[model samples]
Target: MTAAPSLDSKYYEAARPRSLGERLTGAARQRIHADFLRLCRPGPETTILDVGVSDVINDAANGLERHYPYPHRITAVGLGAAEAFRAAFPSVAYRQVAADCRLPFADGSFGIATSNAVLEHVGSPENQRLLLAEMARVARTVFVTVPHRFFPVEHHTAIPLLHYTDAGFRWACRRLGKEEWAQQQNLILMSRRRLAALVPPGRTARLGRTGLPLGPFSSNLFLLLTP
Candidate 1:
């Protein structure tokens, strides 16, 4: 089995605010924050578990803690300690755990659980399912985000059109001078239908698009699941 790509890969780095993708992601973040507020209705006492938190130095690449109304209530988990994150958000709790193992928290331990843009890099469909199941198991409400497969521009490689139609997109990426990114093995583009199917049958869930100028064909898919 292919190992998951490292979180340090350039593919996961934050884009500059001036870049088109980052601008769109910033807009999407606002909508995501609003939806989370409405769906989870987090309060001062609410406990949030943010799984697979990005360790990137860039604030934009980090997790939902930045947007949460109560950052102190969030427990951010990552595969390794993120010194930069710790320095930036001194009040937020951070935990490090093995990437391949189950989440360290007990079932329904948090009022909200979230992960952003981390699912595609988990390496396989089975692992993706496990990640989602764990999120659902540990929180009464779950919010997750992933890049939409059919988006015209593939966010990671910044290549247009080929990601959806070509199985050889990786090769195409290398041919287009994105050799370094193409070498990283773990990105698996996902569609709304596939994401919906991944939810365990009993969970009540809704799926929608955010990051406009593309509307339903937006670059990201936002999923909310509740028990």
Candidate 2:
């Protein structure tokens, strides 16, 4: 990946001193990983393309990288620098994706394609739809995940119910010193209806909840789609 030295400054580039949020997030991801394996049932030779992998230096940050039995079969792409990720999982091929969030591969490039907690960061609803289309374009099976808006605590800022509305959430984020997350392009809350509309036409999209199941108020949302 051609990430500049400056790019790694923003994310968690260290292993020690992990926060409670990161720890909990990691545990949730482990559950997601289990679900992924169960649903996909990938064989040893099955290659997976993991879109929008984080460069955060934590054991729990990239769940598949930390525990996957076949690391070499994974190809990960992201916008930020991944020097630490490369060092940690040398078997996985890491690529620097552009800000447009397009996957640079042909149709059916991998057996399966996946992205975790990245839809919110891609800007608008239109952009989110495009991401879904691209992932579907490049793989036979697509699995994507995003945080639920009603999760009680906002995943990015860790604030409570102030994020129930768009205007109020932005205002509160600025007041609470989370100015970065205030920007819609940086972070936007997602609901069940919002996520359901993102899948392109003709695809059989099966939406599910994970982390905690509280009917409409779940901790996370996942999409398992097929063309």
Candidate 3:
């Protein structure tokens, strides 16, 4: 599978200042976090679990802490082998964990568990379930976000490929001399109905679901679930 280009530089440059502005303007780290604050009703005593934390210098925890109620503990775990995350949030706790599937945490260990765009990169449906299960087991609430299936894969890289059916999309790619792009390597696309099945029915409840602008009409769906 061809690795997508670093979303760090381009995304960071544009999204960073905007994110900081959100913090200043009280946007909280995207819609999910805004929903989290509403649903979880986080206080200074709350603790958060952030899965699949990246190797970025300014991690989400700090950003959330800045916006949302602070003095709360945030534990971030990810697969990357970079100390940048550690150095970035020296005051907060940080750990390195595999993003493939299993999460090493006890049941109901946190008030909230969050994963932003992590499930798509999990590589397989089974692994995605494992990650979701772990997210549910560790926290009473789980929040996740991913690119909508309707969104073209190349659109993620700012290259708009033709809008094709799931099968037709791949077939058309092959005809267009881009067959290799069709391989189902990572970034599994899932529907909202499918995602709702991941957590326990009785324990889970959708806090919010909305499409945020990725470009203009295109956007990513963000969900906040209580499990």
Candidate 1 TM-score, C-alpha based: 0.87
Q: TM-score of every model?
A: 0.87, 0.90, 0.71
Best by TM-score: 2
Worst 10 residues of 1 by lDDT: 1-10
Ten-residue segment with the worst summed lDDT in candidate 2?
7-16
lDDT value, residue 194 of candidate 3: 57
- Candidate 1, residues 110-210, lDDT tens digits: the string is 99888777787776778888888888989999988888878787877777788775456777766887664544246777789878878866799999886
lDDT against the true structure, each candidate: 0.73, 0.79, 0.57
List residue ranges in candidate 1 displaced over 4 A.
1-9, 177-185
Cand. 2 TM to true fold: 0.90
Give the residue spans of candidate 3 off by over 4 A. 1-29, 58-72, 151-155, 159-164, 168-181, 200-202, 211-218
- Which predicted model would earn the best lDDT? 2
Ranking by lDDT: 2, 1, 3
